[model samples]
Target: VLDPNSFTGQEFMMWTVAVYGDGWLNFWKELKPAIKTVAPGWSEGWVKFTTNEAPLMVGYATSDLYFDEKSSDKSFIPSEGGYIYIEGASIVAKKEIKDGAKLFIDYILEEKFQRLMAEKNYMLPVTDIKLGDEYNRVPTSTKLVKVKTKDLEKIEEYKKELIKLLKK
Candidate 1:
């Protein structure tokens, strides 16, 4: 288990701010009491969660897809909102193999590729690929929260504040 006073929590707070925007610090403060044991990272946390050492642990909603037997675990999308970490494929500037990179990107965006990724990687499809029944069990909120690119400019400052707050 990670020490609650450790920098891990502070780093998580920083990530929360980067993805969920402002007010995460206040939420963390409020929720701290309920958080009994903290793990050094997600892998450790996942072990704790699976072994029932922790009643609640942070992870992807689609995590159930990786399990052999579908767990009763449910993902709750808070009425306030939830954060989505978006992943993208980008072609680096001045790349030697630009055509290959473009082809890869195009292939990735295809429905078949998206479906395969959603199934194998246990992640949400970026394209309009049909999802499996497992995905239906994951609760989705209409009010998903996102940090604007403009707000991202202050991420470093937010990290500093998060560290200070966690240290307190």
Candidate 2:
């Protein structure tokens, strides 16, 4: 069995279509195995990393997007392919605003605001921009060295069954 303390990191792909996809059991099943791979001796209480860092901002992880920098060596890229879907709140309004309010919303959709959000908020912007050094310094960046287009597409499906074989 692997040592619990010896574990470096894990990216548990937690989710459930029911309850709007926020099911702990669903998350546990996916995460438990990855954690076990890192530390076979680990149990539920042995791990602790919740979603309180930026509670307002949902931080969903992609297999291609690792979270813990220490996990680089213990990374798990699934072979069957599956992406961790992150659900975040939107700033939508019941009714569209007029004038400056509308302009401000429109501006947010622009590249300028997107880059600023990425730089200041530490959230990846949907826009296409080379993440500058400032943004790259974050621990998140260390885990997310972008993969190629083809590889990126295949990330969610990756089963990384090799990890299981390694346990033997």
Q: Which candidate has the highest lDDT of all?
A: 1
Pairs in clash, predicted candidate 1: none
Name the TM-score of candidate 2. Answer: 0.34
Cα lDDT listed for each candidate: 0.67, 0.39
- Can you give the TM-score per candidate against the true fold? 0.72, 0.34
In model 2, the Cα lDDT at residue 56 comes to 19
The C-alpha RMSD of each candidate to the native structure, in angstroms, is 4.4, 12.8
Badly placed stretches (over 4 Å) of model 2 are 1-59, 62-77, 84-97, 133-168
Sequence-dependent TM-score of model 1: 0.72
What tens-digit string does per-residue lDDT give for candidate 2 at 65-120? Answer: 33444443232323433333232434567676567766776777789888886666
lDDT of 2 at 22: 30
lDDT, candidate 1, 16-87, per-residue tens: 665555676687677666876768776788788888999977666676665655567765755656666567
